[model samples]
Target: MQLNQALEIFMHGEIGIPSAENRSSRQQLAGLDILHSDDVWNQQRQIADEAIVQSHAPAEVLALLADYQPSVDHRITLVDRPTSEHAAYHAAGYRHSASEVLLARSLNNLPAPDPRYAVAQATTIADMEWLNTHDPAKRAWLTVTRLLEPRLRHSFIRLDAEVVARVRVCQVDPAHSYVTNLYTAPNYRRRGIAQALMIAVLQQAAALGECWSVLIASEAGLPLYQKLGYQPLATLTVFEPAEASE
Candidate 1:
């Protein structure tokens, strides 16, 4: 899939349908598509100029973002394929805050699941709550549980009666699946829980005839993904206003 199209699908799955109160507004400025969601969650607002047209003045993008509520400290993702737009953001006082490497692999021969972990689908609110309780940051994604499009699936692995690891997979299309929110409790890390969980998820995706799996891996997770046979396709940079960096 095209990078921009994959990005749009990834963001939609990540942000879901913004609540009525945090609904986003969009505008085209200098060939840049900007989305402003007054959501306290930074991921809800973003700026993307995937086409590299560079027609939009960076000042205009900054000015528009400044209007967002709690804008100074709130973060936003700046999707620029051509590095040329980087200077505009720097001039606008947005700092390079974080980045993720995009990775993809053809689901040809997935590894066998480790018997040490048992993976199962999360089927109810209680199941999701269990996941968030173990990793509070996941609470922000409660909205994804309510989304119907793209066929969301949540899977978890339990040890004795406690959920120890979790992962979310979105079937973006019959031929593609996106994985996100893969988390294993601190106590459970390095015990093969994550690898096992991923093996199970990808197996399911393959069963559904999905041939490709895509994900944005953090620096720490890069090695594991590489070991799983995913190769870097691109890099996505996220920027935050200067104040937010401070």
Candidate 2:
């Protein structure tokens, strides 16, 4: 898929439909797509809000975000834009929080799943809560994703009776799948668990007739994704209240 097409799919997946409980919302103000989700877990690490810069002037977008303040602490994410464009936001008191690369790959020729490890899908709220016993915030995030994202699935592999690695996949539409939060336990790093789990995810997406999978990858995870045929699309820069950073 073209970079533009992949980005469109990625943005749509990120700004998903709100849950039935009304815990989140998406809006278009000042020619920017903005999102806000209540941090139900009350954890600082939980995501609260973001702004996607399309063709909007940075000044206009900043003013809109400034006016519509959310009740809880929030951060804004500006995706696929140049560092120069981000300077205005930085000057406005939003400090850099993180950066990640957008990646996409065709699911046409996914590798076979590893035989030794059995991959399991978290299909219910109960399943997610149990698997994420170690982190309530992560568990809450997964539950929210299950409610907000379309055709959501969380796949994982266990070691020593605990989840050692996992990935979340969303079938955003008929032909596209979005992957996020691919994580491995610190102790399990360099064990090939993440690669095997992702192969399983791609195979699952292909089985459901999805054609493309997209994700945001950190520098540490870039090599693994490249080996799996994913091509980088753009850099996503995240920003938060300067006080939050301080």
lDDT (Cα, tens digit) per residue for candidate 1, span 165-198? 7778977767878898788777778988899889
Candidate 2: tens digits of C-alpha lDDT, residues 104-192? 99988777778878898887777767676843124444664564445878888888877888877867888998898678888887878
Query: Over all chains combined, what TM-score does candidate 1 have?
Result: 0.74
After superposing candidate 1 on the true structure, give the runs of residues whose Cα lies further than 4 Å from its correct spot: 1-5, 17-30, 35-88, 136-150
lDDT of each: 0.67, 0.75
How far residue 169's Cα lies from its native spot in candidate 1, in Å, is 1.5
